[model samples]
Target: MEDQREIAYVESVARGWTMEDGEDLSAMRRALREVRARALPMNMSMDLIRRTAEERWSS
Candidate 1:
């Protein structure tokens, strides 16, 4: 049997978030966009990529 891999499964991975109520959703999406541009080409693991994205959102 071949081993299976799950990609982009949000529940199985750690999420980086600490948003207060009423935060701007557009801002969060912008941050994620920047992080995605940087993280996607680093050849990093998905967990690392997600963590990085979260940091980008907060920062």
Candidate 2:
């Protein structure tokens, strides 16, 4: 269901993205590498992106 959307902005951003696409793949991996540096210190969910999503859309 994640692939389905109703908003134009979301559809616009999602239209052409795919992991198989080689566009900016290296930089994307590097950014993910930086994200992987975050540690699960003292009991925390490894879900920083969910927090980012909530912050982005829960206005």
Candidate 3:
């Protein structure tokens, strides 16, 4: 049903927006720091990262 689907979507978004799992959020902070560290040194944009990662992964 549409209502059930909407409820599921809202629940998923709520879960992401909240720390119900006792998540420390440090992993995300560390990942962001790593991204900034790499990007700043190379002047990389989001597109560059995506393309580079794709090429590296595919080869």
Model 1 residue 32 CA deviation in Å: 0.2
Model 3, residue 31: distance off in Å is 0.2
List, residue by residue over 12-49, the lDDT tens digit for candidate 2: 55485344334455667667788788746433554666
Q: Candidate 3, after superposition: displacement of residue 23 in Å? A: 4.2
Which candidate achieves the best TM-score against the true structure? 2
Report the lDDT tens digits of candidate 3 across residue range 1-59. Answer: 44542111123644644332223345555676898776644545666888889999986
How much is 46 displaced in model 2, in angstroms? 7.3
Residue 31 accuracy (lDDT) in model 3: 70
Better of 2 and 3 by lDDT: 2
lDDT of 1 at 46: 77
Task: Kindly provide the TM-score of model 3 when superposed on the true structure, using C-alpha atoms.
Answer: 0.31
Model 1 segments beyond 4 Å from truth? 1-23, 42-59
TM-score of each: 0.32, 0.34, 0.31
lDDT of 1 by residue, 1-59 (tens): 14542222123256644443334545666777999887644555777878888999876
In candidate 1, the residue pairs with backbone N, CA or C atoms under 3 Å apart (3 or more residues apart, or in different chains) clash, namely none
